[model samples]
Target: MDMKKYRSTMKRILGCISRYQWGVAASLACAFVTVILTLYVPILTGRAIDCIAGAGAVDFPRMWKILKQIGIITAITAASQWLMSHINHWVTYRVVKDIRTQAFNKLEILPLKYIDSHSHGDMINRIIADIDQFSDGLLMGFTQLFTGVLTILGTLVFMFSMNPAITIVVVLVTPVSLFAAGFIARRTYRMFKMQSQTRGELTSLVEEMLGNQKVVKAFRHEADAQEQFENINEELRIWSLKATFFSSITNPATRFVNSLVYASVGIAGAIASINGLLSVGQLASFLSYANQYTKPFNEISGVVTELQNALASAARVFELIDAKPQVPEDPDAAVLNNARGEVSLEHVYFSYNPEVPLIEDMNLKVLPGQRIAIVGPTGCGKSTVINLLMRFYDVTCGSIQVDGTDVRHMTRQSLRTNYGMVLQETWLKSGTIRENIAYGNPEASEEEIILAAKEAHAHGFIRRMPQGYDTVISEDGGNLSQGQKQLLCIARVMLCLPPMLILDEATSSIDTRTEIKIQKAFSKMMEGRTSFIVAHRLSTIREADVILVMRDGHIIEQGTHESLIFQNGFYAQLYNSQFAV
Candidate 1:
């Protein structure tokens, strides 16, 4: 990531941490106390050594007091470490939870196009794998990092108090070790970044394969799918291997440097002891402090590696959080109240991609309570109109108005609340049948839910099920037929009772008989409501108040179904083709 982006991400993470500042402060304080106790061990060992060397003349009472102090310090250190661990755990968990909740809430506000441009698997990976990686760093890496610094500082102060010459020798090696660690960490971070990206791709591939297992089996494309997956898997393996290899080298290399420094300190201390430059007890204490100093160097190196990995994950997460939604709402947008369902498209032009306009300067009007049928070839932007109407995407140019109010000036939530939609692909959450029906309005009463189900002709089938309206559905309603799933979606939309409804090929997957039944239910639901229907079956649109025949993003013919057939244009040809089949 660029420096500016990295700084921004750090700011956001720090903001998250600041909310739990009290927990963080407590954890840090405990760590400092633990480090203080750790530093006292060398002092206790030194005094015990002196008492032993002094033979019978040594102060037994002083020795006893030193031992007692050591025992007390050890107990306190254990308690402090325990408290620090728990505090760090609680803080990290809460921070991660808040981040996840914010990400989900932002997702709800983001436009559909933002979701469409991103892979579901990758998004899910950010929420799961990325967040998990961050929590590990926050809980373990941050605690160790702070404690290591405290230990190093405490050891240095005590060592200098004993002898500045020996302290200087130990401090001289610090910068070299730190520089080496920084270099290794930078390289390791690059590898970790690549690893996280590859992992996301791998996740996406695996998710796609599992979600389409049935299609893969039917088409006998198992080998092909496996080959594709192997490519992504191989990339992930390479990245992981590289990251592990580099990260592993850091610890061993730091250990080697530390060993060299310890050897030097041992040689220097031996000379100092022989020359009477240091007491035997002081020499032992100096050596202990040397060991303590080198240990944090090793810890620092390890933490650097961990911090790098976390930074990589954080970068990925921040990318999602920082991304601008495809369609942004105006800051001064107004809330649209109780719409009358009259909609007008004044010279409207739109496209998923601006380079290719799907609807060009198309003007149309639908009076309140009118039922309009839209028919066209597969790529004629039939669904795109629904997308634009719902503001899932904004028009590239021109304007769309609802109830004489410009949609662009209205809050997206309020604008969308005025309409109900039944997509071609129905998605039902894992819940009871009644729960699914009331999904549009969670506060809806049980009676209202049943009434909507009855209107959509879904009540009969639901009643026949083992649990009737209480029958629990699986995710995506796998237990129900396509027609039944469509009916459930219809019932969901009906319960909302929006002023406008859009049914985009909602019955296309059903059989002819089921289609007729669903059409009847839809007819009842659409009464006195502005409705837009997009269907391939001409028979389904014949009763529409107005029929619009679109091709190549333009309305080539439009009129009542009978008038269009009488005109013998594109609409007439479409009718003849469907009836002939």
Candidate 2:
């Protein structure tokens, strides 16, 4: 384990907890009171024992006084412990909540590349599972650790006052416990980290399989998927057991050391009492202090093991919270408003990977209210163009301009707000149809939502639902047909009616009949608006004002559909091939 990284992670964890300064102070005060009073009670009990062992009749009044004091101390200690427990819980959970919130907020501003590269399930595990583990470890630390250390110190002080020799014996044996616990903890930290990572991988694998069970079943790859899952599961099991084994060793090792300390303290106290160096009361107090002193070692050793795991888990959470966010917008960036939809790509170049070019020196210009169609084969940068235009990914070189202003100069939110997009993949949250339709324009009225749905030819099916527009769609529109889900997504964009529109196979899932109806609706929607259509079907874009045929990241043909067909080039061959088959 890198001690420096662990130390850094610990300091950050402390910083998060320190936000609740009042709670920390309160818990500290309670712990101090509880441990002091708890240690003091043993002295009181020893005094009561001395009263009973007196040569004459037992000093009943003195015994009664000591017992009363012990009772009061016990009550106060219990009350302080209760308050401390509540405060610790409050502080620990608040820290957890704060960290979880920061992780989620980081996700929002993170670049698309990060989201595309990382596993969603692993991210979810970090936010949920790892944080919960951190919470458990932190809560244990707050509840046991502070008091344990204080109790140890308090016992040493009391034992020293009673008899220095016995106190020395107890102190001399402590390093053994510390050494044993530290040795095991150092090795366990790495194992726990691997355990957490493997658990995340397992979560990602399970999530992948569950999310695509249909594909697995269709492909008849159940046996293969099962074998893959078992491999990950077996790896997770190994890491978990190894981590658990090493951590478990810490407790027993510390306990054995603690037992030796207790035995030495008992032997030394007996000798001291026999030699007239201590009274019976003092010797009894010494034994009690020894037990109290050594008890914390066992507790702290367990805490140390947990802290190792907590630190490991915290490192992962911190990694996410500290992840580099998307490039910051200019402090004085212009906000695009009421855009006229004149978009231009001036020598724009982009690639998902720097090593392999995807779109190079791509140039295009669209007049306001013109329909531009982009047709290309797979992996030909069609959607990449849309992504660059939407600012989902920035260009590697040159610039894209909207309304004669470079898009990079505009705030992403304002730029995105002005353009409505509907892709082939439909997304619907679990909500009423009306709510999903109004997601883009949340303030839209019921009539407006219905109008957009009707325009997208989705109103008929929606109205037939048990509750019409109020019918709650299941997760991802599981209750609805794929075409219906696509229609809802289309209605969503239609409701926004942005100044600029991008329809990338927007009607792919709909049947041919609904496709034609939706096409008519789209035609009305696109009128007087700048639209970019990315279509694989040649039949869809024959009337486009400008057709840009792209191949290998370059636009090789650009003209009206008739002109491109007349050229008998790549575009003509592509258009004729669809008809030929």
Candidate 3:
């Protein structure tokens, strides 16, 4: 929508293309050769006609030789076109691959809040559809535009040299037609941009529906989902039609203009021949050049339409590529090594949005090897604390320190490497159980993986499966039970053996018996590790060295479990409500 932004994106795209300048040069050379060959065809036809009319003993052998030469030239032209296409494809694909890699790297560095604000479907569309569209544009659009321009220039020079009167008639109509074509192209481009955005929205809607298919079935919301999809689909169709209509108009308008100019050239050439100003061979040659000259305008109009479409796609793709990550580490930040696990949050205040503070003046200290449990009502900043500690979001005020070093002063990789985390929802890629366990510690030996699995109490169950530790799991561990998925996460964390651990509702989904089994494994994993637990079930955190109760962006209470129970405060009330028989 913004012209400045569009210009900036174009600059970036040009810069990317400049990286493969040699390949682009080779492609352009091939396009020029093909155009040159194409222009020679009309001249050759005119020569053959002139020879036939002269009646010079009818040189059939010479005619055959000329025909063979034209055939050879045609074959070479085809080969040149093919080479140009392959080169364009190679360059476009390489640039697109680099763009995708850079986009993903940018995503990795961006803060969690950026991802939270963007939809999964929209991002996926940019990565897949937008990039694919850009590739198409760069490959086909470049070749067509370059060749069309070259063909037009070569034809113009030859036409004027053959006969200026006919050349002028044909040339006079070109600017008006080009101006009309440009206006139509601009309208089509705007429609194309809107169509791309709407398609992304449609893709997002379908993804959401499929992801929540269980919810939709349970609530019998099939009709609602269908209606929502139809709305987006209709909008997409309208935009698509507008783009198609405008693009379709350009070719017909161009052809009509070309027809008018061709008629003018014929009439003017006939007059010159009648006035004895031009010979029959010259008149015929002028008409042939007239057609050749008009061919480029037709080619230009078509290429302009295609380029408009490609440019629209390029603009969308570049918008994402140009987005700056929300969080950036200092260039001089140092990597931490052998970090002591002592963490302190000093008078910290933070918010995802500045208007709504999620955590305010939060102060806490965790001694090395101490296990602290954070209990709170939903949306009471329990998870926000973990986010801040991990530097997923920076504090708006005060500071957080790990081992007396400011977190902001340390490299993000170093800070994260010192801690291990187990989330409420277990996520695993489609791979063998062994691969998932060794994900955090890629260099961990087979013996170490087996030991970690044994420690997490996952060895028995995994061995019972068809492939034992080598059994393949679906992405997100869909093939495994909820309990088994949690165990896999635990084994992954255990393999890392980070000094600091954060267990975020780790047993929230397991049954009572499985919870007990997991809790025992968790206790072993937590030993001598500085750990933070966010739990809704009070019984699970009863043995925590310290418990902090949080509410409405503040710490409401802090004490040991026994002391809090004796005090009969928020923690005690929550415990009585959940644990009472």
Model 1 TM: 0.96
Each candidate structure's count of clashing pairs:
0, 0, 0
Report how far off residue 384 is in candidate 3 (Å). Answer: 0.7
lDDT of 1 by residue, 355-435 (tens): 876799898999999999999998998988998899888888899999888898899889888889999989899999988
lDDT of 3 by residue, 1-581 (tens): 35675577677888888999999999989988998897787667666665676666566776677778789999999999999989988888998999888777777776687788888788888888878877776766676778878877887887787787677777787887888788887677788888889999998999989877888999999999999999999999999999889889988898888788788888998999899877676777777766766776777777777666667777766666667676677889878887778999999999888887688888998899999999989999989898988888889999999998889998988999989998897889999999999998989999999999988878989999998988988877877898889888988998998889999998887779878878898888888889999999889998999999999989889989999999999888998998668
TM-score attained by model 3: 0.96
Order the candidates by TM-score, highest first: 2, 1, 3
Report the candidate with higher TM-score, 2 versus 3: 2
How are the candidates ranked when ordered by lDDT, highest leading?
Answer: 2, 1, 3
Candidate 1 stretches with Cα past 4 Å from truth are 1-5, 326-332
lDDT of 1: 0.86
lDDT (Cα, 0-100) at 386 in candidate 3: 89
Local accuracy of candidate 2 as per-residue lDDT tens digits, 52-159: 876886999999999999999999999999999999999999999999999999999999999999999999999999999999999999999999999988888888
Against the reference, the lDDT scores of all candidates come to 0.86, 0.91, 0.84
Clashes of 3: 0
Q: List the residue pairs that clash in candidate 3.
A: none
Q: Please report, as a residue range, the 10-residue window in candidate 3 with the lowest summed lDDT.
A: 49-58
Q: TM-score of predicted model 2?
A: 0.98
Q: Estimated TM-score per prediction?
A: 0.96, 0.98, 0.96
Candidate achieving higher lDDT, 1 or 2: 2
